[model samples]
Each structure stands twice: as structure tokens, then as C-alpha cells.
Target: MALWGGRFEKGVDAFTQEFGASLEDDKAMAQQDIRGSIAHATMLAKQGIISQEDCDAIVSGLKDISEQIADGTFEYDVNDEDIHMAVEKTLTNNIGKPGARLHTGRSRNDQVATDIRLYAKDLTRELLEGNVELRRTFIDVAEKNFGVVMPGYTHLQHAQPVLFSHHMLAYFWMFTRDYVRLTAAYEAADANPLGSAALAGTTYPLDRAYTTELLGFDHAIPNSMDAVSDRDYLLDLEYACAVSMMHLSRLCEEIVLWSSTEFGFITLSDSYSTGSSIMPQKKNPDFAELTRGKTGRVYGDLMALLTTMKSLPLAYNKDLQECKEGPADAAKTLLDCMAIASGMLSTMTVNADTMLDQAHKGFTAATDVADYLAKKGMPFREAHEVVGKLVLYCEKHNKGLEDLTADEFRSASPLFEDDIAQDLDPEGIARARTTYGGTGHDAVRAQLKEAKAALAADEAALPKAPESK
Candidate 1:
């Protein structure tokens, strides 16, 4: 029988019963549902809404069910509409009348809200820790490859020379912003909604704050109507996941390019790579490509929930049932992607000599040459035109900018001197970027220091992570 079947004359049709069931997704929150019930039972007894004997029985029954759930021995019937119904029916059958009393002054509307908030709290914590580890990997890679210079690109064209370490650490800041967004999502889920009871506040003298303390929530939600209806926290979490995936996709796109024969900047480790089925020589970066493709999946998860909650009325509705699966999928996907990225990057071999060789091509030293003419008392705009004409001369002669002699340089602007070769050196061009946050060696080291400090602060703010396999 359905939990709310007392008002209906007949049972629901079998197909509709099966179609409306949510046990598949709700099963993931079995422990959360049990925990919220225990807190509510204890609070009800304190407020004299239920006798002490009933409260004791409810707590004992719930704890035992929790054990059954942990060991995978608990049975879930196909007819069970949700985890709440499965648990309540079992509790009533075992402990009889007191078990029936477990739902006193409560509703599935508020109960499910509390369960999702608790579940989101745990999920966000693990994501924050995963973020910390991924950021640590970036710092490790940067410090290990500190002195190597590579081409820096604008519009995929080499525009300047930059330290490889600086390039890697640029991603560290993108993910640091992700950490902040996830933390906001966690805070949004920290409010307790248990005592809101369906849609209106309960009339049975329930102590909402007492339950909040028992459940470790920041506070009881002040507005009862808002408590059972809103799923904004889930949206926040899914949005955070989407943004993090976008950042991962960008890094993976670069990995695909760098591992190609055309660029030859890095090589994937065999364990993180795969072989093409028909081509024995093909060592494809399939994992990176997969991560990039899954980015759209997470974005879809975010949009699904946004569309679900867009026009719902002012109180609880069945539409809220559509909220759970999306955020849960997003968080798990992000955590798994972070783990894969850490392993893939940590094992890959960086081809430093090849990167430096490529850095010297494409007239990457052109900006430094232009600066040279400007520093020699020429207006910068006129110096830009002088450099443009010089590049054309090199193209006409089939030579590079570095291959031009001082006589050839002075032909464009008399400001050019024989000693300009130092400015034209690729490494010197990279080292000349000594400003804060620039790609110079010293600047990159300073960024590493600042990044480490930020990472340590974020780690300290989180609970100690559980040991991982």
C-alpha cells in the first residue's frame, strides 16, 4: 500500500506505481534518511510530542537498520516509492505502534530536504579535498620543470616565450576559483529544514533548533514555506561542478595538442594512454579526450535542474523529485575527473628540449625586438611599423628575425645596434618578464610560493580527508 493511500479508494495501477517510484536514486540517501529520523525522534520526545518509550524504540530500530544498510543486507521492494517509505514501513513492522509514531509532526517534503542537504554536505567536502590534491599536482609539476621555456600562444599563434612552470601554474588559479565556488555551495546546504514539516510549520511544539544541533546544521531555516520548496543548494553545487569541468576540458585540449607529433611538447605515460585498435604505432591520449567530452555532460546536468526548478509554485511540489540525480552525478563526475587528471599529468614526460626549440620559432622574439627600437629613442608606434617592415623583409629573403644582421636591422631603423642579439635571445626574452605574475623564472617562483600558501590555507579549512586507495 502507498504511504498516503488512506484517502484514495483504490490502489494505484502497477505501471503508474512503477513509473512514479524513486527508490533507485533515493537509495543512495538511505543513511541520511535514517540519521534525520533519529534526530527528529529525539527532538519530538524532548518537546513532549511523543512519549519517551516511543522515542527510545524509534532510535534503536533506526540504528539497527543503519547497520543493515551498511552491510548491504537490507531489502528494497520494487513497490517502495522512495527510501523514506521503505524505511518507515520497515520500522513500523518491526517496532509496531511506536514505529508508526516516527512520522509524527513530519512530512516527506521536509524529510527529503534534510536528507539532500546532509548528502550535499558530505559530497562537497570530498570535492574540496579532491580540488586540493589536483592543485598540489599542478604545483609539483611546475616546481619540477621550473627553468624550461616554452612558446606562449595568443590565437594559437606563438606570441612570446614563457616558462613551462608559469604555464602550468596558470591552471592552478583557474581551479582555485573553483574551490571558492564549491565552498559556497557547501554553505548553502548547511541549513536545517527538518522541523518545517511538509509546507507549513508544525503545530506540535517542535524544537527546530534542538534538531538542528543534533544534526550539526548551522541553524534551523527561519521561513517554513521556503524550507521545503527550494533546491537552490543543488543548483549551486551543479553549477560549481560545471565550471570545474570546463577548466578540465581546456587543460585536456592542451594535452591533446602537446602530445601530437606536430607540437611534441609532452608524451603521455602508457598507463594513462591507450592504443588505437588498428594502428599499432598510435598511442592516443584517450583519457584526456574522454574528460573533455564529459564536460558537456556535466553542463547538461546543471541545466536539467535549472529547468526543473524554474517555474515551480511557492511550496513543495513533486517537481522537486527531479532535483537529486543531477547534482549527485555532477559531484561524482568532477571528483573522478580530478583523480584522473592528477595521475595523467604526474606521469607524463615533458619534452623540454623540443619545447625550447619550438619556442625559438614563429618570430617569438619579435615583441622584444620592437621594444628594443622603442627604447632607443623612437616613438613606440613608429617602432611597431619599423618591426612590421623588418618582418616583411625577412619573409621576402626567406630568413627568420634572428637571422637578420645588425646592418639589415639598421636598414629599417638606425636605432638598431649590433648588441641587440642579447634582446633577441629567446631565453633572455622570457627572463626579461620580471614583473609580478609575469612568466620570468623569478616571477614564476614567487607565484609558486603564493599558490602554496593559498593551497595550505584551503586544506586547513577543510576536515582531514579520509585515506584513499
Candidate 2:
């Protein structure tokens, strides 16, 4: 029978029951639901709402159910609707009246809100840890390729020369921002909502603070209606996932481009690469491409939930039941993508020689030449024009600025001197950018030190995993 079948004359239609059931998706939160119930049961006993013996029976029954779930021995029935109903039904059958007393002062409204918050908290911490690991991988790659020069791009056109370590640290900073957003999501979910039964304060003398402390929540939610109705924390988590996925997708796209024949800047590890079934010469960056493609799916998950919550009325409703799967799938997708990207980066072979080769092409030293003329006496705008004409002359003559003789440079700008040749070397050009946060050796070394310290601080600040009451 359905848990709410007291006044009904007949059973629900099978199709309706199956359609309304959430066990298939929500069972992922079964452990969280059990933990929430344990805390509530303990609180109920402390408040004299239930006898200590009954609380003991309920706690023992829930612990047994938790083991069954972990061991894959828990039987799920579609007729039970959701994980909460399934676990409660099984508990009632096993422990008799005490199990029935478990729901005395709470409703599924607040109960499910509590469960989802707990689940979000746990997943957010996991993502934070993964972000830190991925950042560490970035640091490793940066330190490994410390002084390698590469072409920095503006609109896919070579704009300047930069160290590869500088490029890697750029991503390190992006992920550091992602870590902050994920931490915010965790804080948003750290409130307890167990005492707000069915969208209103319950008649029972419930001590919400006891449950809050038992569950390791920072505080009990102050408003009853808001407690059961709020899903902003879940939104926060999914939003963090979406943004982080976008960042990963950008990195993956670069990996794909770099591994291609035209770029020839990187070669992915064989374990992370795939071979064509028909083409004997084909080695593909399939994992990077897949991670890039999965970015859209994570974005869609965020949008689907945002649209579902856009026009809903306050308090719990059936629509909220549709919210769990989106964030759950998004979190898992992002976590897997982070792991894959980290592995690909840690194992991939960087072609520093090839990068340096290409870094010298495309007149990547033009900016330095322009700056040379400006420093000598030319106004910056006039220096830019001179370099533009020089670039055109070099293209027409099929030569690079480095290929130009001092006399040839003097033909374009009288400011040119014999020292201008040194300015055209890609390594010198890259190393000359010594401003803080620049691609120069000192700047990147400073940034790397800061990144390592920031990562260590985050690891130290991450909260320990919450234990069951």
C-alpha cells in the first residue's frame, strides 16, 4: 500500500505510481536520508517526543537499513514512491511501532530538503578536493616546463611570446576562482531544515538546534516556510559545476587543438588517446573532445533546473521532486571530467621544441620590435605603424623580423640599432616581460609560489566530512 493511502478507497493506477516514483533517481541520496533520520530520531528522544527505547530501536533499524543499502541488499519497491518512503516502510516492517514513531514531528517536505542539503554539502566538498588536485597537476606541468617559450595569441593571431609555465598558471588561477565558488555552495547548504514540517512549524516541542548540532549543520534554518521551500543551495552547487565545466571545456579545446597535426604542440598519452578503427595512422584526442562535448550537457542540467524553479509557488511541491537528478548528474559529470583532464595533462608529452619553433614564426617578435623603436625615440603610434609596414615588408620578402639585417631595419626606422636583433629573439622577448603576472621567469615563479600557497590554504581550510548522528 502507498504510505499516504489512509483515506483512499483504492490503490493508485500502476502507471501513475511508476510515473510518480523517484526511487530510480533519488536512491542516490539514501544514505543522506538515513543520516538525517538518525539525527531527527536522536533529537526527538532528547525532547521527550519519543521514548528512549523507541529511539534506540529506530536508530538500530536505520543503521541496519544503511548497511543493507551499502551492501546492495536493500529491496526497492516502485509503489513506495521515493527513497524516504522505501526506507521508512522497510524500517516499520522490521522494528514495529518504534519505527512508526520516527515521523512524529517531521514531514517529507522538510525531510527531503534536509537530505538534499546534506547531499549537496558532501558533493561540493568532493568537487573542492578535485579542484585542488587538478590545480596541483597544473602546477606540476608548469614547473616541468618552466622556461619553454610559446606563442601567446590575440584572436588566434600570434601577439607575443610567453613562457609555457605562464600559460599553465593562467588555468591555475581560473580553477582557484572555481574553488571559491564551490566553497560558497557548500556554505549555502550548511543549514539544517529538519524541524520545519510540511511548510510550517510543527506542534511538537522539537529542539531543532539539537538536530542541527547532531547533523553538523552550522545552524538550524530560522524560517519554517523557507526551510522546506529553499533550493538555492542546490542551485548554487549546479551553477558552480556549470562554470567549472565551462573552464574545463576551454582547457580541453586547447588540448585538442594542441595535439592536432597543424599545432603539433602536444601529444596525448596513449592511455588517454584513441586510435581510428580504419585509419592506421590516426591517433585521436577522443577524451578531450568528449569532455568538451559534455560541457553542453552540464550547462543544460543547470538550465533545466533554473527553468523548473523559475515560476514555482513558495513551499514544497511535486515540481521539487524533479530537481534532484539534474544537479546529481551535473556534479558527477563535472567530477569525472576534472579527473580525466587531470590525467590527460599529467601524462601528456609537451613538445617544447615544437612550441619554441612555432613561437618564432608569425612575427611573434614584432611587438618587441615596435617597443624597441618606441623606446629609442619614436612615438608609440608611429612605432606601431613602422612595425606594421616592416611586417608587411617581411611577408612580401618571405622573411621574419629576425631575418632582417640592421641596414634593412634602419630602412624602416632610423631608431633601429644592432641591438634590435637581440630584441627579436623569442626567448629574450618572453623573458623581457618582467612585470608582475607577466610571462617572464621571475613573474611566473612568483605566480607559481602564490598558486601553491593558495592551494595549500584551501586544502587546510576544507571541512572534515560530517559523521552520522
Local accuracy by lDDT, each model: 0.92, 0.93
- The count of residue-pair clashes in candidate 1 stands at 0
lDDT of 1 at 444: 87
Highest lDDT against the true fold, candidate:
2
* Root-mean-square deviation per candidate: 2.3, 0.7
Please provide the root mean square deviation of candidate 1 (C-alpha atoms, Å): 2.3
| Model 1 / residue 374 / CA error / Å | 1.3
Summarize candidate 1's per-residue lDDT along 114-230 as a digit string, tens digits: 999988988999999999999999999999998998999999999999999999999999999999999999989989999898898877899888888888888889998999998
For residue 314, model 1's alpha carbon misses the true position, in angstroms, by 1.3
Query: After superposition, which runs of candidate 2 have C-alpha atoms over 4 Å from their true positions?
Result: none
lDDT of 2: 0.93
